[model samples]
Target: MGLQNTKAPRAKRANIVMLGLDFAGKSTLLYQLRCKDVFLTVPTIGFNVDMIEMERDFTLTFWDVGGQEKMRQVWSNFLEDADGLLYVVDSSDKRRLEEARKEFELILKNESIKNVPVVVLANKQDLPGALNAEEITRRFKMKKYCSDRTWYVQPCCGITGEGLRVALERVATFARQYSRSKETFRNLKEMDTL
Candidate 1:
Protein backbone atom coordinates (compact mmCIF):
# COMPACT_ATOMS: atom_id res chain seq x y z
CA MET A 1 0.00 0.00 0.00
CA GLY A 2 3.13 2.27 0.26
CA LEU A 3 5.87 3.18 -2.16
CA GLN A 4 6.71 0.25 -4.46
CA ASN A 5 5.44 2.42 -7.30
CA THR A 6 6.54 -0.21 -9.81
CA LYS A 7 3.07 -0.56 -11.27
CA ALA A 8 2.57 3.13 -12.06
CA PRO A 9 3.35 3.71 -15.69
CA ARG A 10 4.48 7.36 -15.57
CA ALA A 11 4.51 9.72 -12.62
CA LYS A 12 6.57 12.42 -11.00
CA ARG A 13 7.85 11.54 -7.55
CA ALA A 14 8.68 13.80 -4.62
CA ASN A 15 9.92 12.84 -1.17
CA ILE A 16 8.76 14.85 1.86
CA VAL A 17 9.71 14.38 5.51
CA MET A 18 7.39 15.00 8.46
CA LEU A 19 9.07 16.48 11.55
CA GLY A 20 7.65 17.66 14.85
CA LEU A 21 7.47 16.94 18.60
CA ASP A 22 6.12 13.64 19.89
CA PHE A 23 2.33 13.26 19.61
CA ALA A 24 2.14 16.16 17.23
CA GLY A 25 -0.06 13.98 14.98
CA LYS A 26 2.49 13.25 12.27
CA SER A 27 1.90 9.50 12.28
CA THR A 28 -1.84 9.92 12.59
CA LEU A 29 -1.97 12.20 9.61
CA LEU A 30 0.06 9.78 7.53
CA TYR A 31 -2.30 6.93 8.40
CA GLN A 32 -5.35 9.02 7.60
CA LEU A 33 -4.00 9.87 4.20
CA ARG A 34 -2.82 6.40 3.24
CA CYS A 35 -5.42 4.18 4.87
CA LYS A 36 -8.30 6.68 4.90
CA ASP A 37 -8.77 5.88 8.59
CA VAL A 38 -7.14 6.66 11.93
CA PHE A 39 -5.75 4.31 14.53
CA LEU A 40 -4.21 4.51 17.97
CA THR A 41 -0.71 5.56 16.90
CA VAL A 42 2.19 4.93 19.20
CA PRO A 43 5.15 7.25 19.33
CA THR A 44 7.13 6.73 16.19
CA ILE A 45 10.28 5.09 17.57
CA GLY A 46 12.40 5.80 14.51
CA PHE A 47 10.46 6.66 11.35
CA ASN A 48 7.63 5.63 9.07
CA VAL A 49 7.52 5.82 5.26
CA ASP A 50 4.53 5.82 2.96
CA MET A 51 3.83 6.89 -0.60
CA ILE A 52 0.53 8.21 -1.92
CA GLU A 53 -0.54 9.51 -5.27
CA MET A 54 -1.33 13.22 -5.31
CA GLU A 55 -2.63 15.52 -8.03
CA ARG A 56 -2.10 14.01 -11.48
CA ASP A 57 1.00 11.96 -12.12
CA PHE A 58 2.55 13.07 -8.86
CA THR A 59 3.45 10.66 -6.08
CA LEU A 60 4.18 12.13 -2.65
CA THR A 61 6.50 9.98 -0.57
CA PHE A 62 6.40 10.81 3.12
CA TRP A 63 9.00 9.98 5.78
CA ASP A 64 7.70 10.52 9.30
CA VAL A 65 10.46 10.46 11.94
CA GLY A 66 10.31 10.20 15.70
CA GLY A 67 10.16 13.47 17.62
CA GLN A 68 12.07 12.62 20.76
CA GLU A 69 15.18 14.64 21.58
CA LYS A 70 17.38 11.66 20.79
CA MET A 71 15.70 11.08 17.45
CA ARG A 72 16.30 14.67 16.35
CA GLN A 73 20.06 14.08 16.29
CA VAL A 74 19.53 11.66 13.42
CA TRP A 75 16.89 13.71 11.60
CA SER A 76 19.43 15.18 9.24
CA ASN A 77 20.19 11.73 7.89
CA PHE A 78 16.77 11.54 6.30
CA LEU A 79 16.91 15.02 4.81
CA GLU A 80 18.89 13.75 1.87
CA ASP A 81 16.98 13.79 -1.44
CA ALA A 82 13.98 15.40 0.25
CA ASP A 83 12.03 17.84 -1.91
CA GLY A 84 9.75 19.36 0.74
CA LEU A 85 8.94 19.33 4.45
CA LEU A 86 5.85 18.83 6.66
CA TYR A 87 6.42 20.46 10.05
CA VAL A 88 3.73 19.56 12.58
CA VAL A 89 3.19 21.48 15.81
CA ASP A 90 0.87 20.83 18.74
CA SER A 91 -0.77 24.25 18.76
CA SER A 92 -2.78 23.41 21.85
CA ASP A 93 0.36 22.93 23.93
CA LYS A 94 0.94 26.57 24.65
CA ARG A 95 3.44 25.77 27.37
CA ARG A 96 5.86 24.37 24.83
CA LEU A 97 5.51 26.83 22.00
CA GLU A 98 8.96 28.14 22.75
CA GLU A 99 10.38 24.63 22.72
CA ALA A 100 8.77 23.94 19.36
CA ARG A 101 10.24 27.19 18.13
CA LYS A 102 13.72 26.19 19.16
CA GLU A 103 13.42 22.81 17.49
CA PHE A 104 12.05 24.43 14.34
CA GLU A 105 14.95 26.87 14.20
CA LEU A 106 17.35 23.97 14.43
CA ILE A 107 15.60 22.30 11.50
CA LEU A 108 15.90 25.51 9.51
CA LYS A 109 19.60 25.62 10.25
CA ASN A 110 20.24 22.27 8.65
CA GLU A 111 21.80 23.18 5.30
CA SER A 112 20.27 20.20 3.53
CA ILE A 113 16.69 21.21 4.36
CA LYS A 114 17.15 24.96 4.29
CA ASN A 115 16.32 25.33 0.62
CA VAL A 116 13.34 23.00 0.53
CA PRO A 117 9.76 24.32 0.69
CA VAL A 118 7.99 23.77 4.04
CA VAL A 119 4.36 23.38 5.11
CA VAL A 120 3.90 23.95 8.83
CA LEU A 121 0.86 22.09 10.15
CA ALA A 122 -0.32 23.50 13.46
CA ASN A 123 -1.95 20.27 14.56
CA LYS A 124 -4.38 19.42 17.38
CA GLN A 125 -6.48 22.45 16.57
CA ASP A 126 -9.59 20.78 17.94
CA LEU A 127 -8.23 21.18 21.45
CA PRO A 128 -8.69 24.31 23.51
CA GLY A 129 -5.97 26.98 23.56
CA ALA A 130 -4.75 25.86 20.21
CA LEU A 131 -2.65 28.63 18.78
CA ASN A 132 -4.17 30.34 15.84
CA ALA A 133 -2.24 31.31 12.72
CA GLU A 134 -1.22 34.67 14.13
CA GLU A 135 0.04 33.21 17.41
CA ILE A 136 1.83 30.39 15.66
CA THR A 137 3.53 32.70 13.22
CA ARG A 138 4.65 34.91 16.06
CA ARG A 139 5.86 32.02 18.20
CA PHE A 140 7.72 30.31 15.40
CA LYS A 141 8.74 33.67 13.91
CA MET A 142 8.33 31.84 10.63
CA LYS A 143 9.06 34.81 8.40
CA LYS A 144 12.48 35.12 10.01
CA TYR A 145 13.27 31.56 9.05
CA CYS A 146 11.75 31.54 5.59
CA SER A 147 13.97 31.93 2.53
CA ASP A 148 13.64 31.54 -1.23
CA ARG A 149 11.31 28.58 -0.97
CA THR A 150 7.60 28.79 -0.19
CA TRP A 151 6.45 28.36 3.43
CA TYR A 152 3.05 28.43 5.16
CA VAL A 153 1.31 27.75 8.48
CA GLN A 154 -1.93 25.80 8.48
CA PRO A 155 -4.10 24.97 11.49
CA CYS A 156 -5.37 21.38 11.34
CA CYS A 157 -6.59 18.31 13.21
CA GLY A 158 -4.95 15.04 12.28
CA ILE A 159 -7.55 12.81 13.88
CA THR A 160 -10.53 14.18 11.98
CA GLY A 161 -8.41 15.14 8.96
CA GLU A 162 -9.40 18.78 9.00
CA GLY A 163 -7.18 20.95 6.84
CA LEU A 164 -5.06 17.92 5.95
CA ARG A 165 -6.17 17.57 2.35
CA VAL A 166 -5.84 21.29 1.66
CA ALA A 167 -2.38 21.31 3.19
CA LEU A 168 -1.28 18.46 0.93
CA GLU A 169 -2.69 20.21 -2.10
CA ARG A 170 -0.73 23.35 -1.29
CA VAL A 171 2.46 21.39 -0.74
CA ALA A 172 1.92 19.50 -3.97
CA THR A 173 1.55 22.80 -5.79
CA PHE A 174 4.86 23.99 -4.41
CA ALA A 175 6.51 20.72 -5.36
CA ARG A 176 5.19 21.00 -8.90
CA GLN A 177 6.51 24.56 -9.20
CA TYR A 178 9.91 23.47 -7.90
CA SER A 179 10.00 20.68 -10.44
CA ARG A 180 9.26 23.07 -13.25
CA SER A 181 11.98 25.49 -12.15
CA LYS A 182 14.57 22.72 -11.94
CA GLU A 183 13.68 21.47 -15.38
CA THR A 184 13.85 24.97 -16.80
CA PHE A 185 17.29 25.50 -15.29
CA ARG A 186 18.52 22.28 -16.82
CA ASN A 187 17.21 23.23 -20.23
CA LEU A 188 18.77 26.68 -20.04
CA LYS A 189 22.14 25.19 -19.08
CA GLU A 190 21.96 22.69 -21.94
CA MET A 191 21.39 25.55 -24.41
CA ASP A 192 24.38 27.55 -23.06
CA THR A 193 26.95 25.86 -25.31
CA LEU A 194 29.19 28.16 -27.37
Candidate 2:
Protein backbone atom coordinates (compact mmCIF):
# COMPACT_ATOMS: atom_id res chain seq x y z
CA MET A 1 0.00 0.00 0.00
CA GLY A 2 1.13 3.53 -0.75
CA LEU A 3 1.97 5.84 2.16
CA GLN A 4 -1.05 7.81 3.28
CA ASN A 5 -1.42 11.15 5.00
CA THR A 6 -4.17 11.39 7.60
CA LYS A 7 -3.77 14.82 9.13
CA ALA A 8 -6.95 16.73 9.89
CA PRO A 9 -7.24 20.45 9.60
CA ARG A 10 -7.61 22.32 12.87
CA ALA A 11 -10.51 24.65 13.43
CA LYS A 12 -9.81 27.89 15.33
CA ARG A 13 -12.63 29.26 17.47
CA ALA A 14 -13.02 32.63 19.20
CA ASN A 15 -15.81 33.65 21.55
CA ILE A 16 -15.94 37.43 21.36
CA VAL A 17 -18.12 39.72 23.45
CA MET A 18 -19.15 43.05 21.89
CA LEU A 19 -20.03 45.99 24.11
CA GLY A 20 -20.43 49.79 24.17
CA LEU A 21 -22.84 52.55 25.14
CA ASP A 22 -26.38 52.57 23.72
CA PHE A 23 -26.60 53.29 19.97
CA ALA A 24 -22.90 52.67 19.43
CA GLY A 25 -23.62 50.34 16.46
CA LYS A 26 -23.02 47.04 18.31
CA SER A 27 -26.05 45.35 16.81
CA THR A 28 -25.45 46.87 13.40
CA LEU A 29 -21.83 45.70 13.45
CA LEU A 30 -22.89 42.20 14.48
CA TYR A 31 -25.43 41.87 11.66
CA GLN A 32 -23.13 43.46 9.14
CA LEU A 33 -20.44 40.90 9.92
CA ARG A 34 -22.88 38.02 9.71
CA CYS A 35 -24.90 39.10 6.64
CA LYS A 36 -22.60 41.55 4.85
CA ASP A 37 -25.58 43.93 4.69
CA VAL A 38 -26.80 46.95 6.59
CA PHE A 39 -29.60 46.15 9.00
CA LEU A 40 -31.86 48.52 10.88
CA THR A 41 -31.77 47.53 14.54
CA VAL A 42 -33.56 48.89 17.54
CA PRO A 43 -31.94 49.19 20.96
CA THR A 44 -31.12 45.70 22.12
CA ILE A 45 -32.89 45.17 25.42
CA GLY A 46 -31.27 41.78 25.81
CA PHE A 47 -28.41 40.23 23.86
CA ASN A 48 -27.83 38.82 20.39
CA VAL A 49 -25.52 35.99 19.42
CA ASP A 50 -24.20 35.14 15.95
CA MET A 51 -21.48 33.03 14.39
CA ILE A 52 -19.19 34.04 11.54
CA GLU A 53 -17.02 31.58 9.68
CA MET A 54 -13.79 32.82 8.21
CA GLU A 55 -11.10 31.40 5.99
CA ARG A 56 -8.96 28.44 7.14
CA ASP A 57 -11.63 27.05 9.42
CA PHE A 58 -11.46 30.01 11.76
CA THR A 59 -14.85 30.72 13.29
CA LEU A 60 -15.80 33.72 15.43
CA THR A 61 -18.90 33.80 17.62
CA PHE A 62 -19.94 37.25 18.77
CA TRP A 63 -22.14 38.04 21.76
CA ASP A 64 -23.64 41.48 21.25
CA VAL A 65 -25.03 42.55 24.61
CA GLY A 66 -27.39 45.38 25.48
CA GLY A 67 -25.76 48.60 26.66
CA GLN A 68 -28.69 50.22 28.42
CA GLU A 69 -28.27 51.66 31.89
CA LYS A 70 -29.86 48.67 33.61
CA MET A 71 -28.10 46.19 31.34
CA ARG A 72 -24.60 47.33 32.22
CA GLN A 73 -24.79 45.77 35.66
CA VAL A 74 -24.85 42.25 34.26
CA TRP A 75 -22.20 42.70 31.60
CA SER A 76 -19.73 40.80 33.75
CA ASN A 77 -21.81 37.66 33.26
CA PHE A 78 -20.86 37.70 29.60
CA LEU A 79 -17.23 38.58 30.22
CA GLU A 80 -16.33 35.42 32.14
CA ASP A 81 -15.99 33.28 29.03
CA ALA A 82 -15.02 35.68 26.30
CA ASP A 83 -11.84 34.95 24.36
CA GLY A 84 -11.79 38.48 22.94
CA LEU A 85 -13.68 41.79 23.08
CA LEU A 86 -15.08 44.09 20.42
CA TYR A 87 -15.91 47.48 21.92
CA VAL A 88 -18.01 49.52 19.50
CA VAL A 89 -18.15 53.31 19.71
CA ASP A 90 -20.24 55.97 17.98
CA SER A 91 -17.41 58.02 16.55
CA SER A 92 -19.76 60.80 15.52
CA ASP A 93 -21.23 61.23 18.98
CA LYS A 94 -18.59 63.65 20.20
CA ARG A 95 -20.65 64.68 23.16
CA ARG A 96 -20.67 61.19 24.67
CA LEU A 97 -16.95 60.51 24.41
CA GLU A 98 -16.36 60.75 28.14
CA GLU A 99 -19.22 58.41 28.91
CA ALA A 100 -17.92 55.90 26.42
CA ARG A 101 -14.43 56.16 27.86
CA LYS A 102 -15.71 55.44 31.34
CA GLU A 103 -17.62 52.39 30.16
CA PHE A 104 -14.67 51.08 28.15
CA GLU A 105 -12.34 51.38 31.12
CA LEU A 106 -14.75 49.54 33.38
CA ILE A 107 -15.03 46.65 30.94
CA LEU A 108 -11.26 46.26 30.72
CA LYS A 109 -10.89 46.13 34.48
CA ASN A 110 -13.16 43.11 34.82
CA GLU A 111 -11.19 40.25 36.36
CA SER A 112 -12.52 37.64 33.96
CA ILE A 113 -11.33 39.51 30.88
CA LYS A 114 -8.19 40.98 32.39
CA ASN A 115 -5.83 40.11 29.54
CA VAL A 116 -8.15 39.46 26.64
CA PRO A 117 -7.60 41.07 23.28
CA VAL A 118 -9.77 44.09 22.50
CA VAL A 119 -10.76 45.62 19.18
CA VAL A 120 -12.38 49.02 19.53
CA LEU A 121 -14.55 49.72 16.51
CA ALA A 122 -14.92 53.44 15.97
CA ASN A 123 -18.17 53.03 14.13
CA LYS A 124 -20.06 55.61 12.01
CA GLN A 125 -16.90 56.93 10.39
CA ASP A 126 -19.03 58.09 7.48
CA LEU A 127 -20.84 60.63 9.64
CA PRO A 128 -20.04 64.33 9.40
CA GLY A 129 -18.04 64.58 12.65
CA ALA A 130 -16.76 61.08 13.27
CA LEU A 131 -13.49 60.62 15.09
CA ASN A 132 -10.57 58.82 13.52
CA ALA A 133 -8.87 55.80 15.04
CA GLU A 134 -6.11 57.89 16.57
CA GLU A 135 -8.59 60.30 18.06
CA ILE A 136 -10.69 57.50 19.51
CA THR A 137 -7.63 55.83 21.00
CA ARG A 138 -6.47 59.06 22.59
CA ARG A 139 -9.90 59.99 23.87
CA PHE A 140 -10.32 56.59 25.44
CA LYS A 141 -6.81 56.67 26.93
CA MET A 142 -6.38 53.21 25.46
CA LYS A 143 -2.61 53.03 25.71
CA LYS A 144 -2.67 53.70 29.44
CA TYR A 145 -5.78 51.72 30.34
CA CYS A 146 -5.22 48.82 27.96
CA SER A 147 -1.59 48.33 28.95
CA ASP A 148 -2.24 44.84 30.25
CA ARG A 149 -3.85 43.49 27.10
CA THR A 150 -3.64 43.40 23.33
CA TRP A 151 -5.84 46.12 21.81
CA TYR A 152 -6.46 48.08 18.63
CA VAL A 153 -8.78 50.80 17.40
CA GLN A 154 -10.26 50.39 13.94
CA PRO A 155 -12.17 53.24 12.32
CA CYS A 156 -15.09 51.78 10.41
CA CYS A 157 -18.54 52.51 9.02
CA GLY A 158 -21.02 49.88 10.07
CA ILE A 159 -23.35 50.70 7.18
CA THR A 160 -20.75 50.50 4.43
CA GLY A 161 -18.55 47.74 5.96
CA GLU A 162 -15.47 49.87 5.59
CA GLY A 163 -12.45 48.70 7.61
CA LEU A 164 -14.38 45.76 9.01
CA ARG A 165 -12.49 43.03 7.20
CA VAL A 166 -9.23 44.44 8.52
CA ALA A 167 -10.72 44.55 11.99
CA LEU A 168 -11.66 40.87 11.83
CA GLU A 169 -8.20 39.96 10.63
CA ARG A 170 -6.77 41.75 13.65
CA VAL A 171 -9.13 39.91 15.98
CA ALA A 172 -8.16 36.57 14.46
CA THR A 173 -4.49 37.28 14.91
CA PHE A 174 -4.95 38.40 18.50
CA ALA A 175 -7.15 35.43 19.33
CA ARG A 176 -4.47 33.08 18.05
CA GLN A 177 -1.92 34.75 20.25
CA TYR A 178 -4.18 34.72 23.27
CA SER A 179 -4.98 31.05 22.77
CA ARG A 180 -1.30 30.19 22.53
CA SER A 181 -0.50 32.07 25.71
CA LYS A 182 -3.27 30.34 27.59
CA GLU A 183 -2.15 26.98 26.34
CA THR A 184 1.39 27.72 27.39
CA PHE A 185 0.29 28.71 30.84
CA ARG A 186 -1.74 25.51 31.19
CA ASN A 187 1.24 23.44 30.11
CA LEU A 188 3.48 25.13 32.61
CA LYS A 189 0.98 24.57 35.40
CA GLU A 190 0.68 20.89 34.53
CA MET A 191 4.43 20.52 34.55
CA ASP A 192 4.57 22.16 37.94
CA THR A 193 2.14 19.62 39.30
CA LEU A 194 4.08 16.77 37.82
Runs off by more than 4 Å, candidate 1: 1-9, 187-194
TM-score of each: 0.89, 0.92
What would the per-residue lDDT of candidate 2 be over residues 29-71, giving only the tens digit for each residue? 8888888899989999989999888766888888999999889
The residue-level lDDT of candidate 2 at 163 comes to: 92
In order, what lDDT does every prediction score? 0.86, 0.91
In candidate 1 the C-alpha lDDT for residue 90 amounts to: 93
Count: clashes, candidate 2: 0
